[model samples]
Target: MARVLIVDDDKNIREFIRLVLEEEGYATVESTDGRDALRKIKEHPCDIAVVDVMMPYMDGISLTKEIRDIYNIPIIILTARGQIEDKELAYTAGTDDYLVKPFEAKELIFRIKALLRRYGTGEEEAPVRLGNVLLYQQNYSIKIGSKTVKLPLKEFELLYLLGKNPERVFTREQLIEDIWGLDFEGDNRTVDVHIKRLRERFRQLSVPARIHTVRGVGYSLEVDE
Candidate 1:
């Protein structure tokens, strides 16, 4: 049973969520607010966090960024406000999902389950081989010849996605949405930065696999045939 951390200033809301999650067989820890949620995670190490948007001392967006810096768990931001701006801010802060308040308990459970499944599947993704290099999806590592190398999560995902498709061109916006989540409000330069980093790494390795710029469009991965 995965443990879920519920963070909200509203006691009734926390209790309600706790009950719903427990009914679904998820063990839960409760926090009164964002600051408290941080402490709870350190003490109990939850698999995912369900965080309220507005709170005293620390808000969910700030907490989401802090959590992302420290942990790799999925986060769902809950807010009574349904403004598109709020949704954008939540995703920009690194939350994996969002739920506007007044949500059905069943929908929350479904979203939580879906996020869990997505995270779990990352470890089972098959390794991709490109020419003389191999990208190990299971562990975010790469093998070039006999040496194993590690990659930042985004870089590896971008590499894996392109490697799997070979010559398919992926536009910057497509890459951003796919890798950073559809709600990501950041500039397309985010994708360019990761692509630049990946190119630098491959160049250093002297690999035959290359990530090509599609000029006026996007990028693609290519290897010697």
Candidate 2:
């Protein structure tokens, strides 16, 4: 199932969209504003975002630009404004589609499916950077300067999650949930073993980023410089 982030200030609207998305078999996450949406996306990756234009603190246009800067996910603007000027602004912010409020639920679903097809959710995003180490999402590989090497599934997932949100300390519990899933029956020490393996491998490869233990906390991926 493709995960979607819904960003809207109106409670009714957000709930309505959530219902529609969930009924269609797409998993949904909600945020009241762009700031919350940003934080949510960092914690849980989403395939696309449905962003409302008029929001507190950060508007949809601004949020769209920010998302474009960091993520390769598609963005759809949901707004009450039907003005061509507003539509243009949304496009300029890198939104893939725009839908005005009072739209038919079926139309919204169709547009979403079209965009997903065009972008192909199965495709892995562009390589993400952590210091000089380039983490490739598609092939479970990492590049250090001119050298590239494939990583084991668990190791790549662990490293990718940390690298995607640099400096954010992930406790052992969060690591297991995010990378290993709720059904994980192993001890938290599993995380430590993976971290040690990552450190050793990066050292051997001279990768510019390393996973750093956070004392009482868990760990984080940081640039070596």
Least accurate 10 contiguous residues by lDDT in model 1: 117-126
| Lowest summed lDDT window (length 10), candidate 2 | 116-125
Tell me the tens digit of each residue's lDDT in model 2 across 2-31. Answer: 899999999999999999999988899899
lDDT of 1 by residue, 1-225 (tens): 789999999999999999999998889999988888899899998888899999999999999999999998899999999888999999999999999888878768867866776677312545788888888766778998889999888898899889999999999988886677654688999999999999899889876788899999999999887
> Any runs in candidate 2 off by more than 4 Å, and if so which?
122-225
lDDT score, candidate 2, position 39: 97
What local distance difference test score does each model get?
0.87, 0.87
Model 1: lDDT of residue 225 = 74
